[model samples]
Target chain A: MKKFAELLENLIYSPSTNKKIDLLEGYFKSNNTLENGYALSVLSSNYKMKFIRVSEIKSLMHSKFDKTLFELSYDYVGDLAETISLFWKSNMDIANSKKLPLLSEFIKNCENKPKKKMYDYLFNLLDLSNPTQRWAIIKILSGGLRIGVSEKTVKKALSKYGNKELEKIEKIWHGLNHPYNNLFDWLDNKKPEPIIDNFKTFHPMMLSNPIDEKKDFQILDHKDFVAEWKWDGIRVQIIISNDKVVLFSRNGDDITESFPDITFFSKKNVVIDGELLVGKNCQPSSFNDLQQRLNRKKVSEKIIDEFPAFIKAYDILFFREKRSSKFEFFR
Target chain B: MNILDSRLNIKPLNIFIDPQHPVEKAIISHAHADHAKSGHDKVLATKETIDIMKIRYGENCAKSFQVINYGESLKINDVDITLYPAGHILGSAQILINFKGQKTLVTGDYKTVDDKISTPFELIKCNTLVSEATFGLPIFRHPNANEEIKKIITSLNKNPQSTHLIGCYALGKAQRVINLLRDSGYKETIFIHGALEKICRYYKNSNIKLGNLEKISNLKDFDFKNNIVIAPPSALKDRWSRRFKNKISSQASGWLSIKQRVKQNQIEIPLVISDHCDWNELTKTITNTRAEKVLLTHGNEEALVYWCKQKGIDAFPLSIHGMKEKVEK
Candidate 1:
C-alpha cells in the first residue's frame, strides 16, 4: 500500500523538484505502517537521507487526496512536514515535533533558548530515545548533517574530546578534505603513503577590474611562475596516481564521472593540471566553445574527438612516473 | 546584423549590439571586453577606460582604444561624450553624450549599488537613457545587500559544513565573495579555488582589503567543519563533491532568489546574493534618475520596458549580445 502511494507520488514529481523526493519515495516503498511518530522520525532521519520539499508533497497530496491513506497522513504528519515541503527548506525538529509534543516542549524551554528558537521548539517535540539523538538535532541544525565533522573546529575542540593539542591536530586537519576514507591510516603507518594525486584541483579566478587593477601582474619571477595560454576553456585538474584516476575540484572533490575519457588514458599514476577545453580542429577555443559538453554526465567516444578536447598543461604537481617527484622533495 | 555601429561617441568605443545601428559619436563607456569590442583596431572610451584597456587588451588593443573619463569633455569629430560608473561589473561606466544638444545616457550593463567588485553605478540625467537591462524586469528587483548578506550568514550558520559553490562570472563573482566573507565572524579557514584565490590576491594587491583568504593552490589543508569554500557552480555538483560525503553546497547569485531551483539543484541550499541589480532596483534607479527616456536591453528587456511603460516611464530593452541573450535557450 505504501509502495503504491509512493509510485502515485512519483507520478506527480521528478528528482528536480526536491532532493527529498527520492528519500520519501524510499520511505513509502518500505511497505510498513509507521507507528507513534515513526513516520516523522524516519523522515526526520531522512536528513541522514536528504531534504524534503512541501511543494513536492503538495503535488503528491493534491492528486492522492482522494485516497484514504493520503488523507490519513495529514493527521499523523502535521504542519511541520508540510512546511518543509512547501518552503523548499524546513527544520527537521519542527517536522519531528509535529508528531511528538512533550519532547518539543523540553527543547523549546531549555537547550536552545537564546540562539535557535524554531529548531529548539521543534526538537523538544520529537521522540528522543538514543544518545545519538543529539547527532540528529545537530544534523538538522547543521543543514542535513552527514559525517566527518568539520575537523578544523573539531581539531580545536579535540583538546577536550580527543585530548590532543589544537595545533598538532590542525596539521592533520589540513589533509582532512582528502579523498581517502581511512584517514588515520596515513598517520598510523611509518612510511605513510603519499596522497592520491590523480584528482584535479581548481584554482578560482581572482579577477581585477581594470579601473582597480594593479599596474601589472607580479610575475612569480620567470622560473617560479610558469605562464600558460590562460585558455578560455574551463579549468579542471586531472590526477592519475597510485593506480587511481580521479578528477578533483580545487576544493578537493573527485569528478571522475564527468570526464571519463580524460582518465581512460594510460593506466599509470600521474597528476597533471590543465584546462578542460573542447577544441575546434586542433587548437584550444573560446570558453563558449566548450559549453556544449558542460553538463553531460558521461561523454561518448564520438564526443571525445568531436570536440577534440585538449588541456594546455601548465603545472605538474605529482608524477611518480617522473624524476624530482613532489613527495621526495617535501618528505 | 554585421555587428557595427557608432553611437554617442567617446574615446574608447562601446558596443550597444543593435540590429539598427545608430550613426552617432562612437562613445566607449568603459573597459570591460563585453562592452569594449573593437573594429579596425581604433576605438574610444575614457582616459581611464583606455588606460584600463592597455592593461587588459595590451598595447595593440589598448592603443586602438580611445580614452575618456567623467566630465573630460571632447567632441570626437561630431559627438560630445562623458563617462560614469555603470556598476554592473567592475570598471563599468554609463556613457552620456550630448549629440547635437540632445542627451542620451548609454548605460552599458549597469548596477545601482557599490560592491566589493566595483563602485556604485552613477546616476545620469538624460533626454534618452540608452541602457542594457541586465536586471530590467520587475521580478529582477534586487534585495537590500545587507539583509541579503545576513540571510547568507544564517544559511551558513544553519549548515555548518556548507561549501558555498558560488557561480561567478569568474571575474566579478569571485572577487565579490572573497570581499563579502573577508571579515565575516566565522573564523574558519577560507579556501579559494586556486583560480579565484589568484584573482582575489590581485584585487588585494591592488589595495582593496579583501580580507585574508587562503588559496587552495598553496594551502594543502582544510577542515570542512569550520571553513567556507567558494567555487564555481559547475564544480559543486557531480564528481566535485564525492570526496566529502557530508558537505552541503550553495550558490551566491542574483538569480538564486528568483530561480529557487538553481540553488536547490546545484547545491543543497541557495543564497539570494548577486553582483547585478535586480528588477526592483533597476526600476527604482531608473525612476530616481528621472531620465525622460529609458532604453533597456539584455535579460528580459522587453518585459522591463513594458513594466516601465505601465508606470508611464519611457523604457525599452535594446537588442544586445550580452551573455543572457547569447546563451538563452
Candidate 2:
C-alpha cells in the first residue's frame, strides 16, 4: 500500500537528502512477489532510517515469515555503537563502503554462528538477504572513522545548547563532549572571560646564558634582551571587544571553536600572546607535526591550508581599550 | 559447588590495610596510593578503582568505599569477586577472586596495552597471578606510550618557545601524561597538577578522551615562556623548577630508570613511558593465565620472585611496595 510512515517521514526531512535512498526505486516490482522483510524491519525500527536497499531486504527472505520479529529487529538494527557511530558520523556522512553491500547474496543465506557479540561488528546473519547486512553492523559498531552525532550529543539534542546559573554547564558538559562555536556561546548565555593568561609557571624555557656573551644590549640591555623564537606550541589568547570574540588558554576557559585559525586576530581589540604554531615553509613543526590541527569545529578551507597555524607574537595583553605592561609587553 | 562455597564463606579474606586482620575488608587491586590506602573500615573497589579512590582517597573515600563497576559481581562470605579494566589508572582494576574453586588474580598494577591512561586490559583467566614488578627486570620494557609522548610531542614541533616539564604522578602519573598527549595526536595545550589539578577535572568530566586539555594551576603572571609544564613527582626538585629558568624537568614515572630519568629528571629526554605492567605484561600474565601460582608485588619484588621461579611458574615475592621495614622474602 506504499506507506512506511510515509517513507520515513520523507527521510527525516533531509538529514542526508539523497545519497541513494531509492525507497523502492521506480515503485516496488523487482521480480514482484510482495514480502518485503516485514515491511523492511518495520521501516527500519520506527525511523532510525538507513535501509541501504539490498533488493528490499531480499524479498523478505522468501516469505513463510514470523522470524521472531525478525530476530528482535536484528538487535534493533545492530545498535550502532561507538557513541552511536560518532553521532551519525557528525550529523550524517551516511556511510556504507567497507565492502558488504551484497557479498555475493550475503554468503548463501546467513550462516548460524555468532549468536551475539555487539561492538566489534560481525554477526554472520539471521539473514536479511545480505547486502553487507547493515554495513556489517556499522563497521562493527563504530570502532574506526571518528564519525557522527557527537558535539556533546548535539549539545544534549539541542534544547538550545545552555547558559545562566548552570553548575558549570554540568562541569563544562563534563569535559566537553563535542558541540562548538564557544559551545553555542557557552550553552547560549554568552561566553566571555579568558582574554589571555599563560604564566609560563616554570621551566628552562627562559634559559640561554648565550646570546653569544651578551653583545651590548647593555645592563642586560636595560635588562631588555627580548629576542623571541622559542615557539613550540600552545600559549593562546585572542580577545576582540564589543562584538565579542573570546578564546583563551593560559589557564582560562573559552577556546573559540577549538582554535578556528586563532581567529586571526578577530578585528583586533588586542590582547595578543602567541605561539599556537603548526608550520610549514618557515620552520618549527612536530608535536607530531602540529597534531594535524586540534579539536576542530569546522576549520576547513582544506583544513585551512593543510593545517597552517601561526601566532609567533610575544605579548600584548590588550591595546585600544588599554591594559598593557609586562612593561608594555616586549615587541 | 553449593552455589560456589556460600560465596567464599561470608566475606572471606582480609589483607587490605590489615590490623591483625579479621576481614575488616580492603579489597582494592588498583588505584595506586600504592593500591589505594585510606584508613579503610570497608572497601571493595572497581568502579574504576572507585574512581582512583575518589581522586586519591576522600569524600569520606567514596563514603567508606564500595564500588564494583568493571564487569561487576561480588560476594564476600563466599569470595567470588570481580573487576577487570586495569589498563592502570582511572578506576584501574584487576582483582578477580573465586576462593573455593580457587582463582586469585590481584594485579593492582597492570597493562596489556591501551596507555594514554586506562582501559584496554581484560584478558585475565587466572588460577593465581598477583603481578607487578613495575617493569620487572629484563631491561624493563616500555617504549610506546604513544611513541614515548611522541618524543615530548615531537619536541614541541622543533621548539615553539619550549617549556615542557612532564614529571607526572600527582595521581596516576599526571593524568596519564595528559591522556598520552590527548591520545597521541596532541591537541597541544596541557598544564596540570594542584595534585594533578582536581583529578584532571574529574577525568575531563568523564567523557574520557584526555585531549585539548589545560591546567597549570594558574601560576598568576610569572610568564615562563613557551608553556607545557605537567609537574609533580614531588615538584621535580624545589623552588618550583627554580621559577622556570627556561624550565624542562620531566620524569613521567614507569620509574624512569632509563639509565636514570634522562640524567635524573633534568629530562632533556625520557618519555620511556610507564603506566606499570611490563616484562611482557608480567610474562604474559604468568603464561596466558593457566596461572599455576605466583605472587610478586610492586617494583623490585626481589626481581619478580627471582624471575617467576626462573620461568617454571610457582613463584612468591610479596612485599606490597616493600620498604617500611617488611622485606625478607
Candidate 3:
C-alpha cells in the first residue's frame, strides 16, 4: 500500500507522459503481481467498489473532528478525500505498529460485504493507514483515480514492463480479470499465453493514424486506399455468436447493458466494427442526439424511440469463426 | 482603549506598521515588498531590513532610516516599539508595540520552523496579537525542509540525464533553499538565475554560508544535465528555461501543499518548503501568546478568525490593503 501510494503521489505531481510511464513501470517492477495487477486496475478505473460512500465518509469525519474545522479544511483543500486524509488524526504509535493492508487484501476484505460491514472495515483500515495511504484508499474507494493517466497509458506501462507489443496485450486485455496471475506469468515467460475460449470476447479494434499528406502521399498508391465518410459518432464493435451478443466500445469496455436495442442481430457468428450513431430513415442525426442513449444502465423506451441507434458497418473482422483478411474485406 | 485607529496605523502615535502606501512615519516589518514599501518619509525597521530595502529600492528608499536591532526598543510619542525575529527571511521582524501598557505584536509573515539562514523565531507574549494568516487553513501542513529537499536529490539521482529546474521566490526562498541544499551535503556548485544573483550575494554578504554559487548567465555551453538550477517562478515556464534540455520543472512553495494549485501551475515536482507558518503553527502561536484578542491579517483570515472565536478569544478579520497580493513570498 505504501509503494502504491507513492506511485499515485508521484503520478499526480508528474506532468509529462514519459515521466508518468517511468513511474508506473518502476512501480510494476518493484511490486508483486497481485498488488501490481490491482494497482493497474485502480489506475485504469477498471476496478470499482463503493465500499464506503462519500456521505458516510463525511459523517465519520464529522464524528472525529469539529464540523466547522472539517468544513473549513474541505473548502480550503477543495477535495473531500484529500481533506479527510489530512485532517484524520489517529494514534501514530498504534498506526505504525500495524502494517497497512495490501491493495488485494483491502479489495477482498470489502468485496461482497454488506454496507455496514464494509464501512466498519474501511474505518478501521483508514485508522491504520498513513495520510498518503489513506488518500489512495479513499480515491480507490471512490473509483476515480483522476491522476492524469489514461487507461491507454497504463497499457503502455504494461507493455514496457513485459517487453511485449502493446497490440498483443490489448488483444487479450478485455478477457483478463483483476489479479491477472496468468497474464503476468506469460509476460515473465513462465507460461504460455492465456487462451480466450469465449467466442463473444472483444477483439482489439484497429485504429487509423494521422498521415502527413505531403510525406505519406508520395509513397502510397491511390488504388491501395479506401475512403469512407468519417462519422462523428462513437466507435463500437458488435459481436454476435452462438446465442450470445455483446457490444464493446473502442477501448473494449462492455456496453451491452447500455444499448439493448442494438444487441439484437441476425444469427451469424461474426464480429463487425462500425460507428454507433443515432439516425432516422437511413440518415444519421447529430452526435448530441446519440449521446442521450449512451452510458445508461437502464434505457427508457421513450429514449429508445426518440433517439434510435444503429451501426454503420465499417469493416467485418470475423465471419463464421474464420478471420477475414484485411485486403479481402477491402476488395 | 482603541489600539489601532485603522488596520495599518497605531492609534495616538499615527505610525503605520508595514503599510502598503508611503506615509510620513512608517514602521516597516520586513523588506518584503507588501510589508515594506518605498517613499516613506521615515522608516523604522531592523538594521538588516534597512539594508535589504536599500538594496531593493536604492539609497533614497526613505527620507530617513531608523535602525532598530532585535530586542532594541525605541520611544515614539507615548508608545514604545520593539523588534523580534520573525524567522520568515533574513531580517524579517515582528513589530511589538507597547501602548499604554498594552502589547500588540504584528507578525509580518512568519514561520515557526527554523530555515537556518534566518534568525530563529522568538515567540513574544502579547495582550493583542495581530497575525498574518497566509497559511491559516488546516490543510496547509508544510512538510519538513530536509525531507522536501531530499525529494530533489532523489529525483536528480533517478533521472541523471535531466536538468532539475526549481522555481522559487527570488529574495528569501531562493537563499533558504540554497542553504538547505548545502546543509543536505550537496557539494556541487549551485547554479542560480540572473534575477537571484543580487539577493543571493546579499545573503552571502550577510555571513550566510551558501557554498559555491555560480550565475547561469556567466557560463556558456554548459552541460546542465544532472545539475540543479534555481530561478524565479516565472522563468520556469518561460523561454529562459528552454536552454537546458530535458529540464524538470519544480516549485518550492507552501502553496504546493494543495494538489490543485500544483496542477494549475503545471509544476512537475512540488516541494512544500514554506517561509510562512502553517495552520498548526499559526494556531499554536496564537494560543501560546496568551492574547485575549486577535486581529487576523491577510490569507484566509476568515478561517483563523472563526477558530479564535471558538477558543473564546475576541477576533476580527482586519481588512487591510495589499490583502489580495500573493503572501507566499
* lDDT (10s digit) by residue, model 1, range A1-331: 1223233222222224233444343443343322212322322321122222345434544553333333332432233233222222234445434433232233234334554454334334223311123323322333333222232323333233333455544434333332222333333342453353223333222232454235445532455544346667766667665566666544344556766655446666566666677776548766775776666788777876677666666566556555224454334
Which ten-residue region of model 2 chain A has the weakest summed lDDT? Answer: A83-92
Interface RMSD of each: 14.1, 24.1, 1.4
In angstroms, how far off is A330's CA in candidate 3? 5.8
- Which residue runs does candidate 3 get wrong by more than 4 Å? A90-98, A112-114, A263-265, A280-283, B5-7
- The predicted structure with the larger DockQ, 1 or 3, is 3
Give lDDT tens digits, candidate 3, residues A218-258: 99899887789879899999888886778899988899888
State the DockQ, from 0 to 1, for candidate 3: 0.65
Question: DockQ, in order, for the candidates?
Answer: 0.01, 0.01, 0.65
Supply candidate 1's per-residue lDDT for A284. 74
**DockQ of prediction 1:** 0.01
* Index of the highest-DockQ prediction: 3
* Per-residue lDDT of A262 in model 2: 49
Under CAPRI classification, how is model 2 graded?
incorrect
Residue B69 in model 3: lDDT: 91
Worst 10 residues of 1 chain A by lDDT: A42-51
Give TM per candidate: 0.47, 0.26, 0.94
